[model samples]
Structure formats: structure tokens, C-alpha cells
Target: DHQGKGTTEPGVMHQEPYGSLLPFGLHKGYALATMCEILGGALSGGRTTHDETLVSCHDAIFNCMTTIIVNPEAFDAPAMQQEAEAFLSWVKRSPQSGDAPIQIPGEWEENNRLEREREGIPLDTNSWEKICQAALQAGMPEEELAAFRALAQ
Candidate 1:
């Protein structure tokens, strides 16, 4: 049974329209998930969600990520580098309505990560209080918290 089926459980609840036409056509999503099962299960010789009672039970969750590491010197190195640079430059120069500049996939995340490390991560008061409470519950002394805060600086 799909988890989307209505239940009176206390935790988070999610329900979906069961008819032929679903919101955003969830049938499409189901079809895609079915395709993933075929690729990750049958093709890869792995177990899928349907094969187990618990959703987490699986031989291995196959990652479809494909990475190509090119030895530029083997090919036309300079030309390949020039072409990639030109393409990136064109993408960055493309018109946008937003105030900030357009960024490629990892660029924004890398920048944010660097900025947060340099300037300590800003947590809301409630979240900071919750963290302190958790630390206290875990038997973390005030001196230890102060030491951790000093390390952050």
C-alpha cells in the first residue's frame, strides 16, 4: 500500500487523490517511480520497495549520477577548455529579471557554504534556544558550549 493513503496516525500525514486524474497528475510521478524500480531493480539486479515491508529495506538504492572525468590532453585540450568557458560565459550573460546574477549549479552552494563558515551561521532565536536545550538535555556542560562557540569564532 502507498503511504499516501489516508490514515489517522499522529505523525505527519499525506493523502493523494485516488482517481485517474490526480493533483499535478501524480499518476505521472507513479509512472516515473515505476521506471526507477525497473532501472534500479531489474536492470541493476537490486530489490525495490515492493519487495519489502519496510520502505527502507532494499539491496541498494542505485544512484543514477553519471560523472565523466576527461583527460583534456588526450583530446584537443585548449579547444575543449575554450568551448566550456564560452558556454558558461554565455549562460551567465543571459538576461534575468532578478537583482542578483545567474549562477551555475554548485557555485551558489559553494559561495553560501564559504560565507557561512567565514561569518558564523545565523540561527533564529527559537532555534538557538532549542539547540541549547538539546545540549543541556544531552548533559553538555555550559563550559563545553562556550568552548564550541569559541571554536566557531
Candidate 2:
């Protein structure tokens, strides 16, 4: 089972999972995510846990694999590479707000993940307090959490 959790700052597309679709076109994204559900559920006879209430709310998950079958030799490899590079260059050259630089798909997200790993996840004070309280309620020793807080400092 692949289980992971991530956080993203507000207004950043990479942090917003469904937000990327706006740039790529929402209809296209809907089609793509829908295709994932169909193939995972219908083709493989696997029920997409995203659709079931208990599974959706709790520990169940679904997986889908999408592949593009491309024959590089059918087209000029160098030409294709050049075209891709050109497109990326154009995107990078777009205007930016203040010190922010234009980034292509996955770039901003990778950078954010790396930065957060180094600096620690950014959570508001209230959320942090809530988490600590929850841990205490869950029977986590107060001394253990206090030690962790000391180390975190």
C-alpha cells in the first residue's frame, strides 16, 4: 500500500493537486482522472476506494497506472528533443511576479518538497497545538512530546 501525506502553501499550483488542471485545461484533467478511475475499477475489476464511503474516509486507497506507448524511431529523436526543449524554454521565459521565477510542471513541487524537508513542514501555531493535544489525548506520553519539542527547537 502506498500511503503518504504532503502539504503545500496556498496559491501554489503544485501544492494544489487539482489546481494543475486549470493550466492544462480542466476538461482534459477531468478526462484523465476519470480514465484512471475507469481503468482501475472497470478494466482491472478493482473497486476504486475513492468511491466507497468507509474506504474513502479511512485506510482504503486505489491505484492507476497510465502509460504512453511511443516509438521514438518513428519520429526524428533530435527533432522531438529540440521541440520539447523549445517549448520548455518558452515557458520559462514567461513573466514572473517579483522575485518568483516561472517554472514548468513538477519543478515547483519538487523544490517545495525539498525545501520543506530541510526546513520542516509549515503549520500554523493553532494546528501545531491541536496536533500536540491530539497526541496527548491518544495517550502519547507528555514527556515524550516535550522531548520532541526540545529537539525540534
Say which candidate scores most in TM-score: 1
Model 1 agreement with the true structure over 1-153: per-residue lDDT tens digits = 134564454333222221122334555677876776677666665555443523453223455432447677887566887898899999999999979999988999999999998896888878877887899899999999888767644
Cα-based TM-score, every candidate: 0.50, 0.49
The clash count for each model shown is 0, 0
Q: What's the residue-level lDDT of 141 in candidate 1?
A: 96
TM-score of 2: 0.49
Q: Where does model 1 exceed 4 Å of error?
A: 1-77, 146-153
| Clash total of candidate 2 | 0
Q: Give residue 22's error in model 2 in angstroms.
A: 11
